[model samples]
Structures are given as structure tokens and as C-alpha cells.
Target: MAADSTRPVRIAGASGSVSDRRHAVSMFAANCGDDKVDVIVGDWMSEANMTARGVMKIEASSNISTSKSGDTFAFGDAGAAYEPTFIEAIEPALSDIEKHGIKVAVNAGASDTEKLAKVMTDLIKSKSLSLKVAWVSGDEVFPAVQKAHAEKRSKFENVSTGAVLDNWEFTPIYAQAYLGGLGIAAAFAKGADIVVCGRVSDASPVIGAAVWWHGWSRDQIAELANAFVAGHLIECSNYVCGGNFTGFKSLESKGWHDIGYPIAEISRAGQVVITKSKSGGGEVSTQTCSSQLLYEIQGPWYFNSDVTAVLDGLWFEQLGTDRVALRGVRGELPPPTTKVGLTARGGYQAEVHWFLTGLDIQDKARMLEAQIRHALRDWSDKFTKFEFTLNGTAGENASNQNAATVDFRVFVQAREEKDIAAARFLRPNIDGMMQGYPGSTIHLDVRQGFPKPIYEYYVTLLPQADVQHKVHLWDGQEIEISPPPQTKTYPAQQPSEPEATGVASTDFGQTVKGPLGWIVHARSGDKGSNANVGFWVRHRDEWEWLRSLLSVKTIQRLLEDEYRGKKIDRFELPNMYAVHFLLHDHLDRGVSCSSSYDFLGKNVAEYLRSKHVDLPLKFLNRGKL
Candidate 1:
């Protein structure tokens, strides 16, 4: 395909290190010389940087090296992972902007906030930079904000900033900090035209910018939400524009090096055009963009800003080359809830490794287990539970084919601070062996470990009244909140079931719930995929009430009736309102290891209508809308 000329160029500049931030900004500015660019985005922080930051700061003095990866575990004293410093990456990006006449936004607080803000403030003092810079604080910013809020409990609003941090009380894996476009919006209000953020969910930038540009109102949340969806689609930058194109293999292409950042041209009408750096690589076709949108879309309740984005009304269409438009986007009023990120002391963990050889893989596994069991028996009272995974030459694909060799890995844990004491005491598991097959191939080692704290976050809604929006402006900065969409609905009718035990019996069909209503799964598939849709029942209560009627006697009655001399099997689809009972061996375990679907079976439509033919008047009504 070709690129669109009318769209403003969206640029993505890369900075390999924090020191390169200025260079990255300069590079972006040089590329946009004398031309108008709508938005400038940068990706500075990564996962490895967060872990290292927490560990080295324990004593208030960091002995930690300034690198992403910490010490190694294999070579005696390997360091832990390092987190990116906020100031190191963002300050330069800001500096580059001052050097060049460019307005941009960045992910600053994603790594470290106070440090990053200090970097920005320092740059302002040194260069006399009067740039409009948006601050993207890391997840850590929330705790500090919350602490201040709690201290000013009675005078909450006095201490509370208009832009509230989410999931602060509950610690989230990785950075749980959420930026709902407020910081970027604040920066836009300041007229910097450039926003720098850290750890803001990928889509917040676009959503914030769109809301700022459109002059939307708070009541227009659905439009903001629709913009949020567009942001979600492109925030990963190239991910939507063919970077990880599942349909195509070769990602390498000319001009891919100058991959422009993604741009969402959102209109007040909820019209969105997802395009990328005119200089970027790959195609922005519907297939490419839509696939990214579908990535990890867990279910109907797509949670964000503590609000559930009902995805049913959302639709996508490719309007032109490199332009995919979104429509039918709508959102419900946000739940009056605020989920806080909380951090707490967790459990202690440790592990050991051993290599076994000379055939009898199962025997080797048993022998290793015996050794660990005996060692644990000696100090069994000191620990909670032990877990083992003996991997080696036992299965069809063995690591060592020459002879049956097994690599035994063992893990032990407890809630105590020094829980590995029981494990350390059992160190002799490596040397002590009761079996005679221990030959030259035997090797043992007692692994050492340190107590590392694991952090997690949870989401709980607070009353909408508890959370307030605060808009900070620099000079003439304005806040625009989009209005919700106007909604319309239509009634739908179910298809008539084909007659069973008749010539017109060859047929099949699938059931989907009407718009907005959730389909329920009475039972789940064993393998954790697909649900067995036995029959479609209307009322939500009918599904609940049917389970109560399924007694052991009902099975006996069915056996004595139609299924008397025939064989029958049952399966359930865990995800939807469906179940399937195979009449005879009609469908083999062909499709999904479990027979959730039947391609070779007799007409299931006929069977469902026949089975429930004698349904009570109430039962028939229950299946209807």
C-alpha cells in the first residue's frame, strides 16, 4: 500500500540509553525541520530497569551499577536487574526540545518520578527553558501522592492533586501506575506541545491529546473512551503498523529504520484514523491494525481508569490506504470505584539442581525425590512445602539421547524471612544417594539464594465522588473532555431449530447473545477451552435453575428413555453459554482434545429441539427473549 499525504507526520525517535535522550530529540527535530508535526513520542523505560531500582535503594545509598541487568547468579556474586532512572532519560529529551523548536511528549515517570521531575526542573533552571513539558510519573508516584493524601485526611482536597494516581494502595506486578492522559493534558494546557511521561498505560498519550485537542467535556466520556481504544491500538507504536505482523514473516524493510510514531486522527464524531510515521516501515492495513486491537482483549470488561469499557459497540473499517477508522464506539458511566496499588512483604523462595544419568529415568526421578524427602525429613518442621520438577530423558523428546539422563530441579519455600534454612539444612541431597546406579555421570550442587521481595497490585473501585479531576494549566492551557455517544438498539429473533427424526434433520447453528448482554457458561470444558453448549435457554435464571434440576435420577431417567441402548457423552464450553452431548460416538475427540465442537456428528440442532420437545411452558418461555 501507499502512505496518506494529508495526515500530519508522526515521528518515533529512539534513545538507546538515558544519555541518548537529547540525541534522540535532536534526531527527531532534524527530521521535522521547518515542518509541522502534531505529536512526538518516545519509549525510554523497560521492565529490567524497575527491579534494579528497588533493590539498590534499600540503604538510601545505591551500590548498584548504572546498567539494566544486575549481577549474575551463576558466577558467585552476580548483581540483580537495574531499573531506568527517570531523570537520565527524560531530561535530555526535554533538553533536545529546548535546543530545537519542537513541542513533544514523553514517558518520564514510567521509571522514576521525583528524580525525573528534578531533572526537568533542573533543566528549566539551567537553560531557562520555557518549554511545555508533560510529566509521566512512574507507578511509584502514587504511593507518595497517597501518603500525602492520607496525612491530610480531613483536608483531603487540599492535599489531593486533580490528577489522582490509580491502584496505589495495591501493588501491581511491573509498574501498576496508570496515567489517564491528565499529565499530558496538563502539559498541553501549559502550551509546551510536548508531553513526557513514564509508566502511563500506552494509550493515555493519544487519549489525553485527543481530549485536549477536541475540547471535549467530562460528560463526553464515551468519546474519550473511544479515543482511549484508538490509543490502545497504536500506543505500542509499530505493533499495530506491522512490526509484529502475524500474517507476514519478514519485518525487515527499507525505511523501517526511520519508523515514524503512530498517530490517531480522532474527530469529534468518534471517527479515528490509525496511521504511523510516514517514514515508518510496514503497512497499516485493517488486518494489521485490527489484529493488534484484538491482542489480549480478555473479555467484555476491558478495565481501564477503574472503568469497564464495554467493547460490543466498537467496530473498525479501513477507510483508505494506511487509514483504519473506528466507529460505533460507546462507553458506560465509570464505576464509582478507585483501585489502589499496594505493596507488601511477600514469601521466601530457594531452589537446588542435580544431574542424573545411567538409564531408568523414572527410577532416577524417584531416587532424587527420595533423597530430597530424606533431607526434608531431617528438617521437615522448619518449612512449609517443597515442589519438584525433574526434567530429562524420560519423555519422547529427551535432552540426552546417548543414555537416559535426567536433570533434576527442586524448589522449596516458606513464609518465614529465612525460610530457606530448612532447604540449606537439606543440602546433602546432592551428595547422599541411596541408589546404586550413581556413576561417573552424577553431579550435584547446592544452590544459594537471597530473600527477594515480590510486589503485586489489586484494583477496587471507589465511589466516583471520592475521585476528583484536577486540571493544572501553565498559562492558557485548556482541558477538553469528550461527551459520551448517543446510543440505539434493535431487537433480534432466533432461527427456528431443524426437526429431528425427520428428513430435514441435516443442519447446525451457533448461538450468540444479543448486544450488551453477557452469555453465560453453565459448565466449563476440562482442558480449560471452549464450553459445551447443551442448549440455549433464555432467562439468566433458567441457567441457574437448570443446574438445580440436573439430579442423578435425571441421568437414570434419560438412560431408561431415549438413550436406553445408545451411548452418550457430555462436554461444556467454559467461555460461553453452550454445552454439547454427543449422541452415539458421532463426534470423536478430533477438534479440541475435548469434543467441544462436532463436525462429523448428526444434526445437533435437531437433537436439541427433540430433546427439549416436551419442555414445560415455562421452560420454552425461559429460552425466549
Candidate 2:
């Protein structure tokens, strides 16, 4: 391989390994293979990643030993426990780069720029590396800009000022504000060897580099958009190069112990070529690259670098190992309005579900609503906000063979636990026949599970003045940032299991644990558990064979034994071999209700695993079961 200095240079992007940081840095070092690149990007954090950055900071901060699933109290102001292990692997490469005068830039933290900055400032100052400071967090800002657009009376008003003055009261769980790449590009242009920043929109890193290197302008929106897309593909670090491709087969055969990080070889014109380090995990297929092009994108008008992209003529094909060619992506002039970021105060919320059954399903649904309001009467004074929603309406509509069995959801925000707890006690209301309703049904389950904080999402645009970049440096200089003191909290104890109230039965003896597995199919007239189970299965012949064995009798027997007395109506689709069962009312002595059609239905495959049956069960709606 030959090295070229005249053309826009390429960089290696890698990070995000469960092991040590050295693994990620080393993976990229080996792939660069004598070629000197411009930058290095490390990615951590998911799209809605809620992991507290405070936990990944300062060396003194201790990680809470308790698991996050059961505890929600991990919010400490102290920086998080992040060991920059990847930076270790990059040591040799950094040393080599210093020899050749090539620069490097790595993220301070993947999620929170504010937090990453605190930690990164410490590292650069302590290590004495000639690393420049740059902060990138446009993805976090975009949604705020979107909300401002919707809330403010006019776009011309200083919407960002409104949001900031209001203390950014409308923040989402995850914010990916599309940022212009100019600052990042300027950092590179200024001869920074290593730049540290936070949450730089994936595309911005590359777009910034492109503009910085080529001196492109906002008027070159399409060109900028193309660069943004190319950058975006490589931004996820490995997805575009096949890290998460569902179509990936023969992964072991691909010899990907050290998976490659993607690199986009872009031109001054709006053309791009996708490639990865020679030694990377996964493939660089056109399919894989295209998947990244549209990831989580709501529409074609993807924003970045102050431009909107019009991706009409995207085309790509494999180009040997670890390489895929891309062309035909077009972009148009962007809208005049700029996007902004905001975080607002949020209200408490509760989600409640109730099962409704019997003929005249629509009328039954109406009656169910009335009963819900009546049940809430005692606690009505405590709730400041309340909303009754019919979740999974499409699934409910499809499940009504004779009559609809509905799950109605009610959400409320209240001052005290009992105000919310009122709904939990009301779970037993529909176990049997009601005063005005015919036939009996179980109330099934209530979302009595503890209520967690929920936030509303809003997006708006702020005038350019409202948003500005601030960079702080630390040369072992102590900054006065008082991270919340780290405190350890014990996990809550689990409740003892309730003693069995009745004898258990194992009557429907035989078990065929093929695709259906050892699923406890619910009975008919059950509006909750008897819902559809959906999964993807290739190879039609195998599916048809599985379909042939799942007899109505087999399904009926499963229901009979599971529910003891209720009957079920089985519906099958051999093409997909997906099954939907409409279940009968419960037989739990009118005390416990079985919701056969609730939520997304049961984990039939997982249940079979619990029974020590190893066969896989494919459902129609739920993901792989």
C-alpha cells in the first residue's frame, strides 16, 4: 500500500469493547497497517443510553455493586468509573504518530460531553499528551431545537433563549442534536495532534474534517450532506462495516477476531467510498453499509453541518474484503431555520392495563373505561395529570374473532404512592361477571410494577446566538466542579413467594417442544395472554414441517392444562407458521384472572427453556422466541 499526502486523509475509528480500551485501540493500530490517518474516534453509549457519566468519571469514584435493573438510585454527581483502556492500546500508535507529526482526536466520553470533559480534562493534563480540547454534542442538541420549533409561537423568536431561560425544561432521555462539523474541522485545521470532545454527532466528525480540509461552505449543502452521511456511516464505528448486520452469516469464517472500524474515503464532490481497516470484525457488504445509511432516521431530510440531505440515488456493492463502494447520494439546500437543544421539567407518570372481554367488544371497551374512572374516584384528588390510552389497538382489533378482548391503559401523575397505588388494588375488579356486563374475565395483571420517571420529548430550533461552544483546558489545573458525592446504597430485598392456594395439575401429558416449545398457551375470552407470538423463520420447508405438528388438539390441550377449565380458539398461519390463540375466561376460583391477550403476549420460547425443553419456538409478533 502506498501513502498519499495530497488527498484528504483517512482516519481509523474504533472503541466500545467490553474488554479493555487497549483491545479497541490495538484493533485499530493493527488495521492502519503503515498508513497514517488524520483522526481516531471512540464510541460508547447507546442511542437512548441512560448510563450515568458521573459514574464513569474520577478514579476515586466507586461503582455501585448493585445491578441497575432493581435499583434506580445510581444518580451520583461524582464522575463515573471509566478506565480509558483503549487509550493504552493507542499508546504505541500515538508514539508512532508523534514521530510522523500526524494528529489524533478521541472522545472524552461517548454520552455526556459535560461529564466526558471533566474526566478527559484530568487524563490529558495528567498524561502530558499534546492533546487539543474539542467538544462535539450536536445530536443531543437537535431534539431540543425540534421541540422549540413546535412550542414557540414563531421560529424567528429567540427560541433557544426561551429554552435556556426556562432551564432547558424539555430534555429527552436521549438527545442526538445534529451539530455542524465546523468546530471539529477547525480543531483539525489548527494542527491539533489529539482532540478530545463529547457526543459529536457521528457524521459531524467526518463532515467537520471534510469542510476543514477542503474549506467547504454552507452553500455546498449537498456536498456537506454527502460528507455527513459518509461520516454517519462510520460514526457508529462498526455498524456500517457489518458489526450489527442481521444478514451476517459465517462470522467465525470471516476471521474477524479483530473487527475493522469503518473509514470513509470521500471526494471534494459529493461522492463517497466506504472501507474499513483490513483487520476488522464483520463484512463491508453493500447491504451492511446501506443499513447504516438509514438507521433511526425518521425521514430523508437528515440534518447535519447546517444542511438537509436528499438521499435519492444511494447505491453500493462489495469491493473485495473489508471494502464497499458507495455512490448516488444527493442533498438539497437546507431549510432556513436552525435546530436547538432544550431540557425541561417533566411530570410523574403511571401506566395501567386492564383486560376487557365478552361479545360487543366495542361496547365492552366502553364499559371498561367507565369502571376505570369509578375505580380512580377515591384517588382523583391526588392526581394532577391523567390520561387513558388504548395501547396495542391494532393487535386488539385483530384478536377479536368473536368479540374483542381489550387491554385499556391509564396513565396518571400524582403526589403520593397510594394515589398511584389505587390502580394496583383495582386489578381484581373484572375477574368475573360485572353488574351490567355478561360472561366473566380476569383482570389479568396491572402495571403495579413501581412507577419510574418518564419524560416528554420536544424539539425546536434556536437562533445561532443562543448556542455557542465553550472549551476548557486542564493542565493538572484543579477545576472547581463538585460532582455529587458518591454514596453506596443497598439493593431492595425481594418479597417471599406467596404460598400455593390450590393443587397443581399436570394432566395434558405429552409435550411436543418444536417451534411452539413448552408454551403455556392461555385460554379463550382472555384478552391478554392469548396474544400473537411473532418471530422470523427462514427456510419454508422447516416451518411447514413444524406447522404440521402443532395440531389444534395440541394447542387446545396446552390451554386446558395451563388454565385448567377455559377453552381456546386457535388460529394458524402456515406460510409463517405463526399462531394466535383467543383464550377463555380464567378458572382461578374467580380470584385470579389470566390475561391471554395482553401486551405483546408471553415469552413462549423462554418458558419452554424454563421447562428444560431446548427446542426454539417462533412467534409471529414478538421478536425471536
Measured by lDDT, the strongest candidate is 2
Candidate 1 lDDT over 249-315, as tens digits, reads: 3345534454444566677655677765555467676656544554424234344552245554455
lDDT of 2 at 157: 27
State every prediction's TM-score relative to the real structure. Answer: 0.56, 0.52
- Model 2 residue 390 CA deviation (Å) reads 14
Alpha-carbon runs more than 4 Å astray in model 2: 1-5, 15-23, 30-36, 42-115, 136-177, 198-200, 215-222, 250-252, 255-259, 268-270, 345-451, 469-625
lDDT of 2 by residue, 1-625 (tens): 1223357557555653223234545545444446445556655432112223322221133433322222222222323432234345455555445445544445434345545555554556676655544444333443444555468634422221223334443343333333455656656655555555554445556776677666776677667877877776786676666664444454567755645567777666756777877654677766566545544232334554355665434556567766776666666654443443222223344555655554465676577667766766676677656655544332445545334555555556654445555344244243323653454353345434344332322334443333444333333222121111221221111111111122233132334344342332211111112222222234443344334434445444444445444443333323322333333332211101112222222233223223332233333323332
What lDDT, from 0 to 1, does candidate 2 have?
A: 0.46
lDDT per prediction? 0.44, 0.46
Model 1, which residues run further than 4 Å from truth?
A: 1-30, 33-37, 41-112, 123-179, 193-201, 242-261, 278-283, 306-308, 319-323, 353-362, 378-385, 390-408, 421-448, 467-625
Which candidate number has the best TM-score? 1
